[model samples]
Target: MKAGYLGPKATFTDIAVQNAFPDAERIGYTTIPDCFKAVINNEVDMAVVPFENALEGSVHLTTDYLFHETNPPIRAEIIVPIQQHLMVHPMQYNKWNEVERILSHPHALAQCHKFLHNQFRGVTLEQLTSTAAAAKYVSEHPESNIAAIANELAAEKYNLKIVKENIHDYDFNHTRFIVLAHSHTEILPSLTSTYEKTTIMVTLPSDRAGALHQVLSAFAWRRINLSKIESRPLKTGLGHYFFMIDINQSIEDQLVKNAIEEIESLGCHVKILGSYFSYHTQK
Candidate 1:
């Protein structure tokens, strides 16, 4: 099988794809949207893209595309620990004082904000498309003054020297990646793991009182454990929106099915985005 990921190689997404689909052929795309398009267009059997980061919240590009552009079912989820590093070209001097500017993806820069401010006070910081892309740029430029914040894999992949390791301000940083496929038929049932999670998009009935509460009440009465509940705009107009709720068990459970039925009876719409297992990698 073939899988797509955002990369030139060595980005967190690339690492997650490698960890989750070790035996599959990996295809790298330049951007997150490209990965999604690759899956939607059948350019690849599936795609792994960032959904949320523990430190940085959601990846707007991925979230927005999932909401507006396509409806490909998420086959599984992967959470990988993120360890950002400071790297420079091998020929470049290996000293922090010699670095003139720092390069990385915006999210990586943000994750290491405090460290950058304290360690390299006034260095120029630039954002690239991905962490691995930044590392690739630093490798090709061969300049002595620029450094990139990426990962160990990137440093090795690009043959860059690590000036500093674990540069992220927080030690428990992680990013949640969602595995998406063209449809349910493309999902490999044999590969399903445990820690099941069911994600559903719910649109509340308009002009109703306590509608949102009623939706939650369905799960509450059924004693279902909700792992996450978040809201997003419906894009039709102001004040119109939908909620994405994640339950702690698979949709095959009778309790979960009944809760959805009760929610729909409340004049709301519910769409099961995916009922797949989640994989958590060691930090």
Candidate 2:
């Protein structure tokens, strides 16, 4: 089997793929949308992309694409611990403080905001498509005085030297990545999960006074446990939005099925994104 992920390699998504699908062939794409397209186009058996981060909240690009673009069933979820480090080309190991710029993915830069503000106050912070991309750039241009904020694997893969470790502001840093594939595709046996989850997208009826409250009530009365509930703009117009909810029960459960029916009866539309197992990986 072949797996696609957001990468040039060694990005967090890549690491999740490596841990979960160790024996499968790995293909790297430059962006999250590219990974999704690869799966939709049958370029890969499945695609793994980051969904949300503990410190950074949800990845808007991933969520937006899943809602507006093609609908691929989430096959599995992987949770991985995150550790952001400051690294530079070996040539500038000792002169890291005098670096002209710091580069990383926007989320990574934000995660280490306090560290950067306190240490490199005036340094230029540039955003790249992925953290690994920044490390690759610094590696290729050893003569330049630029540092990258990325993971330890990126530092080793790009042959960069670590100037500082664990630069992220929060210690409880973890990212959730989801695998997208058709229902017929069978995931490799190497992947194991700790629990199960079911995610659904809901669109409430407009102009209804208690439409949102009624939607929640459907699940609430059924005694269904909701893990998360977040709103995203439908992008049609002002005040038009949809909710993405994660339920702790599987779609196969009778209570969950009944709750969906109750919700739909109230003139709301619901889309089941997936019902799959979730895996947790240690650092």
Candidate 3:
């Protein structure tokens, strides 16, 4: 089997893929869309991409792409702990404090905002495409006074020295990555299944009063537990939007099936993104 992920190498998405599908042949792409495209184009059997972060909320790019572009079914989910570190090229290890700029993906930079403000006040912070990309840049430019905020795997992969470990502000930092494929894909036996989840996209009928409330009521009255409900713009207009709802039940469940039927009867559009098991890497 082949797996595609967002990376040059050693990004958080890559780490999740590594932990969940170690035996599969891994291919790295530069962007989340690239990973999705790879799966759509049959470049790989499946693609793993970051979905949400504990601290950073949802990855909008990933969600938007899934809603608008790729539309692949999520086969499984992998939750991996995140530990962002401040790393510098080995050549600048001694002068790490004197580094002029810190580079990382925008999300990583935001995760370490408190640390950056407290430690490196006024230092230039630049957003790269990915954390691993920043690490790669620092590694390639040995003479530059730059540091990168990335994971330990990235530091190891790029041969950089981690000047400060666990630089992210919070300890409960974990990211949810989803496995996308055209059909069913076997999950690793080593992972521990946390729960079953069924994610669906809902578009409420326009100009209908209480349409949103009615949609929620369909699941609420069914006694279905919703894990998450978030709204994303449909991009057609300012008021046009759709809701992404995650239920803590599988689509195979009779109650969940009834709830979807109830919702659709109200003139709302529904799309089942996936019904799959969510797993966490064994500690």
Candidate 4:
């Protein structure tokens, strides 16, 4: 599998992707959008992008792409626990007295919000696109008194030190990621099963009360068990939005696909977010 993940390597997403497909060919993109595009354009076999983060919350970009991309299908899903750490340059530890700012992805900053406010107190915070990028930035700008919050691997890869370990607010915090593929291959079946999942996003027809009820009813009436359903503003028009849902089944299951088709035909758009993996259990 040509797996694409958010990277400079050592980011939480990269670690999760690596854990899920250990031997799969890895392709790192700077942003989740690029990973989505890679899977859509056939540049990669599967692209891993985070759907939601336990502490930091949903990865809006990844979820938004699945709702709007309209091209490549999400073929699989994985929920990997994220262990966030505070990493800084090895040489900067002694200069902690000189450090005045911290850097990390927005979500990363959010996750460590309380800790930062309590510990660092008045240090200025800067945002980077991803934790990996933040690690790289501090590494390259060694003279700057900026440390980054990232994963252990990122610290190692970028030659940083862990000022604090397991800094996340919740130890069980996890991030779920969806795998994207343009087309399923012969070897894919071996990777898919009922234990896997199928994700779909749909928009309700109108603000009418039963719009969402009917759409979900299609699955419930068929006895299809759903794992998740979250709604987001459509962002294109006023007072309109779409929903992202996941079911514990395979896309090949006729009932699941038909239900999806039924929703689309009802004057609402439907998107297949992918059907892959059960929970990416951390061992």
What does candidate 3's lDDT look like per residue over 202-280, in tens digits? Answer: 9897858899999888888889999999999998989888999999999999989999998898889898899999989
Cα lDDT for residue 148, model 4?
89
RMSD of each: 2.1, 1.1, 1.3, 2.6
Q: What are the runs in model 3 whose C-alpha is more than 4 Å off?
A: 184-189
lDDT of 2 by residue, 151-249 (tens): 999999999999999999999899999999999999753656777899999999785788888988988988899999999999998888999999998
Residue 22's C-alpha lDDT in candidate 2? 89
List TM-scores for all candidates, in order: 0.92, 0.97, 0.97, 0.88
- Model 4 misplacement above 4 A: 186-194, 254-258, 261-267, 279-283
Best by TM-score: 2
After aligning candidate 1 to the native by TM-score, how far in Å is the CA of 123 from where it should be? 1.6
Measure candidate 2: CA RMSD.
Answer: 1.1
Question: How much is 148 displaced in model 3, in angstroms?
Answer: 0.1
lDDT of 3 at 127: 97
lDDT (0 to 1) per candidate:
0.86, 0.92, 0.90, 0.77
Candidate number with the higher TM-score (2 or 4): 2
Off by over 4 Å in 2: 189-191
Order of candidates by TM-score, top first?
Answer: 2, 3, 1, 4
Worst 10 residues of 2 by lDDT: 187-196
